[model samples]
Target: MLGRMGRPGLIGLAARTAVVAGTATAVSGGIASHQANKANQAAEAQAWEAQQQQAAMNAAAAQAVAAQQAAAPAPQATAGGGSDLMAQLNQLAQLHAQGILSDEEFAAGKAKLLA
Candidate 1:
């Protein structure tokens, strides 16, 4: 029954403190790193979802445009006045001159008008 003291030595206390501080620092750093990784993953997932939503919207808009074009009514022509036909031909000629329509396209338009 021969023991030293009520408290540990100064060097023993310093060693213990260092061990505790180091362990605390290491655990806190690990937790912070984990949280950052989780946040990064969440942000990336949000960005990916946004991109998918944008793509879907773009597709829907394109479909809407196609549908609108398909549902549009053709111009009505005057039977004997020939005014409407001339206007249509003039429009085709203008489109061809603007390079919006090719030579074959202009020919097709002219044929359709005459027919």
Candidate 2:
């Protein structure tokens, strides 16, 4: 071994080949692991974004429903053919002012009250 310098012997050659193969395997494994971690992180981020979007859409839908509910007409105090005609007309006017009733509906109610 002390006088061998021109080329590696069979044992040395085998040792070198093993070292190179081990290093290549380790490096390739490390690269594969890194790429897998990156892919997993990207997938998680996309899922999080999708969840946020769904939550926003749900919130908007809830707000619209709340607005609709707020705009709906309240139940009348008395049934049909009741004696409080003035009260009914006042209620219709209030609903119109609050934008709950359309213009045509307001006119129809007033005409019905007068009739």
Candidate 3:
């Protein structure tokens, strides 16, 4: 049997076993690394999508506020002796007396009404 198989047969068998084990370990490690990277990429994509949705929602809310402001009616200015002006003046005086309006604000409103 030794003559047929030669002296190097045992060493060659050990070398082949080592090579197979090493190859299997390397391939398994590569596959695991690839799967982890794919998972990370998916997580990043989900986070980015969420961020985009939040931004779009914020933009829509801002646009809604601006549209509401634009569509609202402006305060109608009245000429002298009109009930509206007198009512506004009375309200301003009340607010000032209540301390809701500062002295400067009250003075400015009085000047504007007189002007």
Q: What is the C-alpha local distance difference test score of each model?
A: 0.77, 0.77, 0.75
Candidate 1 lDDT, 1-115, residue by residue in tens:
9867789889989999999999999999999999999999999999999999988866665565446436756667656858867877787688668765557767876896688
Clash tally, candidates in order = 0, 0, 0
| Model 1 worst lDDT window (10 residues) | 61-70
Per-residue accuracy of model 3 over 1-115 as CA lDDT, tens digit each: 3355556588788999999999999999999999999999999999999999988866665565447436755447745557867776786688668765568767886787667
Lowest lDDT 10-mer window, candidate 3? 61-70
lDDT of 2 by residue, 25-77 (tens): 99999999999999999999999999999888666655654475468664355
Model 2 weakest 10-residue run by lDDT: 60-69
TM-score of each candidate?
0.60, 0.63, 0.54
Q: Record all residue pairs in model 1 with backbone atoms less than 3 Å apart, i.e. clashing.
A: none
Give candidate 1 regions above 4 Å deviation. Answer: 1-6, 74-115
- Runs in model 3 with CA error above 4 Å? 1-10, 75-115
Descending-lDDT candidate ranking: 1, 2, 3
Q: What's the ranking of the predictions by TM-score, best on top?
A: 2, 1, 3
**RMSD (CA, angstroms), candidate 2:** 12.0
**lDDT, residue 21, model 1:** 100
